[model samples]
Target: MQTHPPRSIQLVAIPLVLSTLAGCASPLQPQSSSELQRSMVLAIEREVDQAKAAPERRTLSLQTDLTKLEIRPDHLKIIEDEYSVDGYLAQLGALDTLDSPGLAELLGEDLLGQPTTMVPISLENAIHASTGNNLDVEIARYAPAISEAGVVQAQAAFDWTIFGEAQYQDSNTPQPGQALGGGSAAIVRNASQTTSGSVGVRKDLTSGGSVSITHDLNNNNVESSFFGATPVPNPARTTGVTAQVTQPLLRGFGSDTVLSEVRLARNAERGSVSTLRSQLIATTSDTERAYWNLVLRYKELVIRHKLLQRGIEVRDDIKARRVQDARQAQVADAVARVERRRGDLLTARTNLRIASDQLKSLLNDPNLPVGSEAVILPAHDGIEEELGFSLVEAISDAVTNRPELETALLTIDDATIRETVAKNLRKPRLDLIAQARLVGLADTFGNAYDDTDANRFVDDWILGVSFEQPIGNRAGEAGVRSARLDRMRSVVQYRRAVQGIVLDVKDALNRVFTNHTLIEQSTLSRVAQGEALRSLIVEKELTNAGYSIERLNLELNQQEALAAAELAEASALVAYNTSLVDLYEAMGTTLQRNRIDLVVPDANQLAAGESPMERAGDGQQAGEQDAEGDE
Candidate 1:
């Protein structure tokens, strides 16, 4: 009896064979955390590349679950899931792809009549989905509310005022005269009562930097002294009116002042809104990319499996040749057959595992069910590929639409507002005031009305202007200078953004064109490889030839060509999708109907601004660049 190596031993022999051919197969070997992270990143980039080819019309959900999180300036960690991204990439990291369905099942499903729908899930979607449940869009959107509230507060200083006052008091004490005369009761009751009310309207002078007001009022009072022999009538009543005004004459109105700050704040709020919109654009682009990654993975697995079956046929043919020729020993030929079969088997298994893992990660399903692998639906929707004139049109769209560039422009606007405020603070403090009042006093309420005359009313009025200047004004000047520099920086960044966008669009276009050529070349190579295999097979059958050698060689070559063809197709798909993604990103509207949320000072603050209803046909503004330019 002869014993062959156990399956486990054969599996062990895999690495030995791999090492002998082209170094060790260390796919399962432990990798450093950094290495794993790098691999993941590259994987993510590949997915993004694939997604750009296949755009999905996914609606950006208003509510994102980001329960797992840390909001450091440069990084985010999913405490629950053990996932994290460095702060440097967190905003952009949202564009990575998530896991998808298994390739085996998805392909089978496709064969079984259920075509798969392939969409690119952007990195933004993966980050958002995994951390979305905990993300409070409302919190981020809350900023505008606070800004508006600030406006209200700014105006409150000069709106309107209404005041009222009332007092009643009673006291019991011994009277000096009564105590000295040994009065029957040493306690005396004293009481007093008073009431007053007023209503006024106020206004602020924007040009003059002054305060003006007018008021109307009424007063009633009574004073009684019961400690004396008898209660004495002591009643006093008065009614008065007043008008007051104040103006600034120097530095206060010209430079450092509350009014200036209020104006700057309003501008800041507007810029914030623009910034938010930009963030949403970036997130949407990311989500779209991720969705397509799953599709590509599914496609690769199917192709690999097909190649594996071809390898099986080749192995059988090699074995038959060995049996047919007894004189020509076939040790080397048999070994090669075994190597090819093993290599194909290993490759097929590895691809299946990789595809499964990727799908699980994207779905945010770590504990994926035993059979719940990702399945890629056929993506044959046939998106109209942008060609020739469309390419030019797309370029124009991107320049006018990319959100990051637009956001950068808004940052410049924000800086300009700050500069304006800073410059305003450099003015001297100045103010002016004028007040007039009418007063009347009488022993009785009826007499008080009659005594109410300008002169008799104790007419009092005054007008004055005030001014102040800081000795050095160093702080004010420094602030203005700093703001000016910041404004300059913003402008530079804006220009850079525009340049970067133009370059990115052009580069993506070139890639698309290059892939077009590769697709054609790969197709030709596949044809040539097929002809070579057929020729070698015929040659071996026609004559008593050792042509099995040539047949085997052709088979290997054909295998390589087919693999290249598949890869080229994948690349072409990615390049095509990338062009579309770049076009939409430039246009600033990837998810036609639902727009994603942008990262802003307070994204939660703007929650109310984003409506849940689809705005596809709405007359809302599309891209910031065009809107701002028009404005």
Candidate 2:
């Protein structure tokens, strides 16, 4: 002690000694908490790398080469001969009188043959309406309440029960009696009348036991026919009160066995709630897509209308040229293009109508039905801003939020609870039976009860045990095995659901990326086509180029190209917006994105006349404050 090492040296030496001992005991030491977390992170990264190396991911990397071909403007001048001057004048005069019969026919009447009204709605309003009024959502809303009822039913097993029974009997018998003095026997008649009644209350306990208290009463009148024979208290009354308890010592013991049904029902209710959430997500996504589709169709109609007018102009130019040098085939070709453009316009109109009806169908609003003639016009345009996203974060959100995953997990819990009950049932049935009774006898019912209460009567006590085991226990063993398999199946199902959700998230994200790129490329193509059309028109007007079949064909092609490019650009934008909807849905965040909350009412609430479902933003919800003044 006097030669003790310095404090710093002592600490270093102690640590070294402990380290040496630990190394000698085990070559591999347990990791610290921080080290374990680092290892888990590295494992996740490796798994992500492996997933990215999949064939589908590789396919996404391959790109289509789209090279823009440049067109050089032709520098040519037409000599103004008398015939050309006459043709130019003729074209100028015919421009005003040109008529497109095909277009006129299309615009003359409604395609659906119904009076129509245009109702403009925004994306948020559409989603909100669908969540509130969609038939699918309404149908799913009942499931959670039904499952809650099942929970109530399961819990009802433990409620107290009251029972009562009363019976009366009369009997007469004739018997031969022998005298005690050894004389000849005489025929005798014995008659009795009895009244009995019992009343009790019983209740089951969570500990796999039952306790019952019963009160029993009996009154009897008897007569004996014998010489010099009499009975004391010929009419007798008896009252007995018993308290009994039967507790299972082995099979059916414990809360796990007694409350298994209640636990399973609760799990079912959770699953139903998830199902409702999934329905809401689906409805929101569908409504958004339908709304965007209506917008796309409306834009396409405008493009087609312009394309038809252009065709009419080209036809008029050719007809004017026919006054000088235009051939019959040239005019016919121009007319054919006009007819085609008109047909496209008609088709676009039909599509717009169909899209409007689809949106109405999803909304199912009282003012907007599928059979209604009202057309839904989108008040909001497609979102054009780029969305920033990370694949890792997206997958994480899907794992945390997807209703299918939640449902799968709840199912596993349900299976586990059942398995516990089955295993408990495999044990031999052993029960402890105990009972205590107090008996009282008196001439009057009130007096008998008074004696029973005062304990002025004989008391009886019973304590016993019961043991039962099925031979071979085959049924019990099979049940345990079945439950074990079911639990394993549920676990596998959960994994499958997780994989499916991940795949859906990835696919939707890919679509969003692809469509965003398409929007950029389509915009460029549209601009290029517009420029080409302008250059062609300017060159023709400045050069006074005489109309011929080849010239007419070039003009028609350019007009078609521009219209197609415009339509493609609009379609791409709409697709990108719809892709976003799909991504949010896949991530189970559609309702959150739309600022809508799904509320599933409980069974009691439903029974009290509350709605089965209420949307958070809907003004109709009870106790909801109206941001706008109430009507």
Off by over 4 Å in 2: 1-115, 172-190, 223-232, 323-329, 454-460, 604-631
TM-score of every model versus the real structure: 0.59, 0.79
**Residue-wise C-alpha lDDT for candidate 1, range 1-631, written one tens digit per residue:** 0111111100012223223323323221122223322432343233234334543322211122322222332222221111111111122221122113442232343323564323222233333442221123323345565766676677676555554444444433344425546646445544445455555565666554544444333443333245444323355666666777766665445433445556556655664565545545454455445444544554455445555555666666665666664224444554565576566545654454455445434333222322443342222211224344233333344544555754564565566666666776687776777788877666665566566664487578787766776899998899999987886676567556655665676676566566555545543454344444445555667866634655565665666565556556555555555555654555555534233444344334335445321121243222212223323
lDDT of each: 0.47, 0.70
Candidate 1: regions farther than 4 A off: 1-191, 196-199, 203-205, 208-233, 252-273, 276-280, 319-376, 381-386, 389-398, 443-455, 537-550, 583-631
C-alpha RMSD between model 2 and the true structure = 13.6
Judging by TM-score against the true structure, name the best candidate.
Answer: 2
> Using alpha carbons, what is the TM-score of model 1?
0.59
RMSD of each: 20.5, 13.6
Per-residue accuracy of model 2 over 1-631 as CA lDDT, tens digit each: 0111111100012223223323433211122223322332343344345443432312122132333434332211121111121122233332112122332233334547644455556666677778887889888888999998899999999999999999999988888777657878787788889999999999999999999999999998887775424455557788999999999999999988899888888888888999999999998899988988987886676577778878999889888888777789878888988998899988987888889889888887765678876566665566664455656556656755789966875776676677788889999999999999999888888888888989998587899999999999999999999987896787677667767876898899889889988987886676567666766787787775635656777989998987888888888878988888888888788777777877887666655445533433344321111112122
